[model samples]
Target: MIQTIAFYLFAGLMILSGVLTIMARNPVHSVLWLILAFFNAAGLMVLVGAEFLAMLLVVVYVGAVAVLFLFVVMMLDIDFASMRAGFMKNFPLGIAIALVLLAELVLGIGAYRAGALALGTPDGSAAPIVGVSNIQSLGALLYGPYIFLFEMAGVILLVAMVGAIVLTHREQKSVRGHQNIQKQVRRNPDEAVVMKQPTIGKGIEL
Candidate 1:
């Protein structure tokens, strides 16, 4: 009974927050509504057996709060009126792309019904794999046969991060006081260092 009430409470708030997120005139309010929706969704995930997913949702959303604030600030810079001006001009292209997607979906569904392609989901009569939680089973699967692939993915991510750092630190326009190693190395000692001849009681003018 408690679970039922909590589920309903979370689900109802999630739905209402989603609607408000779309309808709110203030972008900051919309983002706050969106965060509320995320929290309720996380709660619903917790009510289900997927505690890992719930924790993941909470951690990711909470950790990237800086990004949410950045988005709210950036909302002020958007030209909504100018974007709306292009709506009619872009409507036909959008409709055409959507129709193409719809057609693809219809064809895919028909082909699936005809069994022309095999989707590898388990059939309904398969016995439940008891004795283990979902996360444990997932970890075993990830680390058992695919550990090498997982390590390679980690390496790839490391390389990508290194590349990004190198790119950003390479050179920048209109930037103040970035170290130019070559320029510093090429400087004459006389120009680089000014010899100070000051009286004992006075300080040097910097």
Candidate 2:
């Protein structure tokens, strides 16, 4: 009964927050609603006994992705009125794409339900002869079977990070960077320091 109640509560909150995420006019408020939806979804996952997925949702999605979204929304100078002007222009295209995606999701779920797609059972049937913990099992499969793909994904993410840095990076003309530190250290005291005298009543000129 407790599980059922928690499930319903989480589901309701998730749905409400998801709707608010899209409906909110302010980008920061929308991101906040999205974070709430993620939290409720994580709760529902935990209630369902998928603690691994629940942790992933909380640690990865809620902690990193949602926080990044919040930061980006807060930092960006977005003109919502200009954005809204383009919304109606793309409404039909967006609706059509959403419908297509909905149809694809329905078809995928139907196929899974009908046993057209055979998913491996969690009873260690299709899993390797190893541990039963979800983390261990996933690690084994990822390292043993999908190592190349995993490495490829890491490389892709690294490239993406570099590209993002390059795009956002700028050279500051006013900021001086340290250079030739070793040379400066090896220089004589005469090159490094100078003592000067000025009139007692007047300040030294630059």
Instruction: Please name the candidate that would achieve the greatest lDDT relative to the true structure.
Output: 2
Tens digits of per-residue lDDT, candidate 1, 135-194, equal: 776677677767899999999999998998888795647559788889889998766656
Number of clashing residue pairs, candidate 2: 0
> Global lDDT of each model?
0.80, 0.87
Clashing residue pairs in all predictions, respectively, total 0, 0
Q: Where in model 1 is the C-alpha error above 4 Å?
A: 65-76, 83-119, 123-132, 170-206
User: What TM-score does candidate 1 get on C-alpha atoms?
Assistant: 0.58
Residue runs of model 2 more than 4 Å from their true location after superposition: 104-132, 175-206
List the pairs of residues colliding in candidate 1. none
